[model samples]
Target chain A: EADIYQTPRYLVIGTGKKITLECSQTMGHDKMYWYQQDPGMELHLIHYSYGVNSTEKGDLSSESTVSRIRTEHFPLTLESARPSHTSQYLCASSDFYEQYFGPGTRLTVT
Target chain B: AQSVAQPEDQVNVAEGNPLTVKCTYSVSGNPYLFWYVQYPNRGLQFLLKYITGDNLVKGSYGFEAEFNKSQTSFHLKKPSALVSDSALYFCAVRDGEVVNFNKFYFGSGTKLNVKP
Candidate 1:
């Protein structure tokens, strides 16, 4: 099945710990996006990549940084995690008007 | 930049009754709109999309959406509501035309509740 996958479906980390969220898609889409959403809230675009080596920040300011060394892989890393970073992170890939989303990673920072 | 608006935070409907979720968009060029649905603790599933031509687009799970260019809206509608239809719905829009890439913007999302 062609789909997007996100690793570590749920994670709990202490503040200041370093962590990276992984996202990969089997579909050869050029556009990949990362969105942050609180429980029962709207999703905010935090980061996105058009293609390999072409990542850009989205509407929301994020402490996390993303790198797209390969087309299928887009990883978001936080040098130092914080309490405010606790939220659900969603990964998506788009071919045209439609976008496919992953199951999402829910993080809880203590 | 393209933008999407889903005015309601929540919509309640009864089983077997028709339901509608409103959405509006703003873009400089022709609009390519889409609808996605999310269940509790799961990924969002693509419900439908409107690219061009047809005013009404049918999609997964007996769901459909009507695109109105003059009104700048693409509202999701279902003939009969079900308890399973209770989920978060999001409307999205992308910039159209050759110069525009596949950049998508989504609405805040609306929660639909179907009471049995």
Candidate 2:
């Protein structure tokens, strides 16, 4: 199994509340990525990091920001959560050609 | 540009029967293809990947994929289906060129239903 973990498998917060989704891996992978997905739907890349201190936005535009302070940790923060932001957030770390994914965080904004 | 396409939204198969999920891709450079399976409300599990060499690549859980460069297709296959195999499957492609190697384009996903 992949050594990646995502905190708070499920989350529900009120609108306008700030939230941070935590993702970490013990694999020491240099490439980390965050993707937003709806229930049983297509995945949209929101943010990714090539390595520590190297973050980049993905093809899809997102309001969330990410920081890669440590090679193992890549956290995403939404300044103000809206109902539209409610979706599953997945964290992944890649090595060579394959990517291993975390359990994922399902967020709900009410 | 890099992109992946899964023609079927869902594929239905009976237990003990063969199953196939189709995927096609487009990339500016050589293609690196992957197949991932996701259970309901869970993270995606890496099934298999095709980097180079042989056209057919075998992977975990008795799964395999054929990489067809001529058709730009990478289709997932299983000799016999099992009920436990029911889930959502995604096909992803990455460009092999140096500049865009890290980026992966994913298909919309195909739901696999294996009936008993």
Candidate 3:
């Protein structure tokens, strides 16, 4: 199993609340990515990091921001959550050719 | 830029029958292909990958994929289907030659339903 993990596997929050989805990996991979997915839909890349102190926005535009202060941790934060932001967020770490994923965080904004 | 295509939106197969989920890709250089399966309310799980050497690569959960260079296809296959195998499958591609190339493009996805 992949060592990557996402906290609060399920999250329910009110609109306008600030939230951070934590993603950590013990694999010590240099490349990490965050993807947003909806039910039965394709995953949309939201953010990624090549290494510590490096981050980039992905193809899909998202309001959330990310930080890569530590090699093992890549956390995504939303300044203000909204119902439109409700979706499943996936974290993955790459080991050369393949990317291993976490269980994912399902966010429900009310 | 790299891109992946999953032509079918859904595939239905009876239990004990064989199954195939089609995928095609485009890339500037040789492609690194991958197959990932997502269960309900869960993140994607790596099923298999094709880097080089073999045209056929086996992966977790009795899943396998055949890589066709001429057609640029890496289709996921299973000899027999099970109801528990029903899930969403995604195909992805990335350029292997590019150094520090981080983009991994994915297909829309194919939903597989194994009816019991």
Candidate 4:
């Protein structure tokens, strides 16, 4: 049972609205990642953090920005949401090899 | 560049029969392979991993994966399939030799359907 949690398991917002997805883990892992996934599709890494104050962009280009001010918390914020931004956002923390994932946030931009 | 591939988009099996999900990977250095399962609308759950020790690694829910260096494959297997086992499966690989070794490449998911 991983202690990772993501808020707003499902979110529906109008286009152009600003929104933030919160991710937290109690395991004190140094490595955290944010991935975007379409329904039943391949995962696209969007953002990751090596540790507090260390954030890096992943392979896929994303409009979202992430911050790692605290080791256990890594939140992603979109300045202006769009219909193209509709997808599931997954947060995970890794301990060397294995990654533990949160429940994920499903976002819909109408 | 490091990458993971799951050739099959979906696999169907009968209950009580065996099941196999194919995975292949390409990496510059030693490959760290892993398998994860995801139920509908849920996040991925780690199934098993191939680090270094054994070619055959057993994981939760009676799942196992065999790592073949010659084939550059780490395929997930289960002796007996269950209806409850139906889900989306993902294969991931991390290159040990990369400067940013923390990054992992994930394969397109394979949907498993177990018919009773």
Candidate 1 per-residue lDDT over residues A7-47, each given as its tens digit: 98999999999999999999999899999998767889899
Error of 3 at B88 (Å): 0.9
Ranking by lDDT: 4, 2, 3, 1
- What candidate 4 gets wrong by more than 4 Å, as runs, is none
10 residues in a row with least lDDT, candidate 3 chain A: A91-100
Estimate, for each residue in A29-68, the C-alpha lDDT of model 3 and write its tens digit.
Answer: 9999999999889989999999999999999999999999
lDDT of 4 by residue, A1-110 (tens): 89999999999999999999999999999999999999999999999999999999999999999999999999999999999999999999999888999999999999
Clash pairs of candidate 1?
none
Reference contacts reproduced by model 3: 0.88
DockQ of 1: 0.78
- Candidate number with greatest DockQ: 2
Q: Please say which candidate is ahead in lDDT: 1 or 2.
A: 2
How many Å off is the CA of B60 in candidate 3? 1.6
Question: lDDT by residue for model 2 over A6-33, one digit each (tens)?
Answer: 9989999999999999999999899999
TM-score computed on alpha carbons, candidate 3: 0.97
Q: What's the TM-score of chain B for every model shown?
A: 0.95, 0.97, 0.95, 0.97
| Residue-level lDDT tens digits of model 3 in B1-116 | 57899999999999999999999998888888999999898888888888889899999999999999999899999999999999999999976557636778899999999998
- B66-111: candidate 1 lDDT, tens digit per residue: 9998899999999999999999999988877565556777899999
Which residue pairs collide, candidate 4? none
The segments of candidate 3 whose C-alpha lies over 4 angstroms from its true place after superposition are B97-100
Superposed Cα RMSD, model 3: 1.1
Per-residue lDDT tens digits for candidate 4, residues B1-116, read 78898999999999999999999999988899999999989999999899998899999999999999999999999999999999999999986785878998999999999999
Off by over 4 Å in 2: none
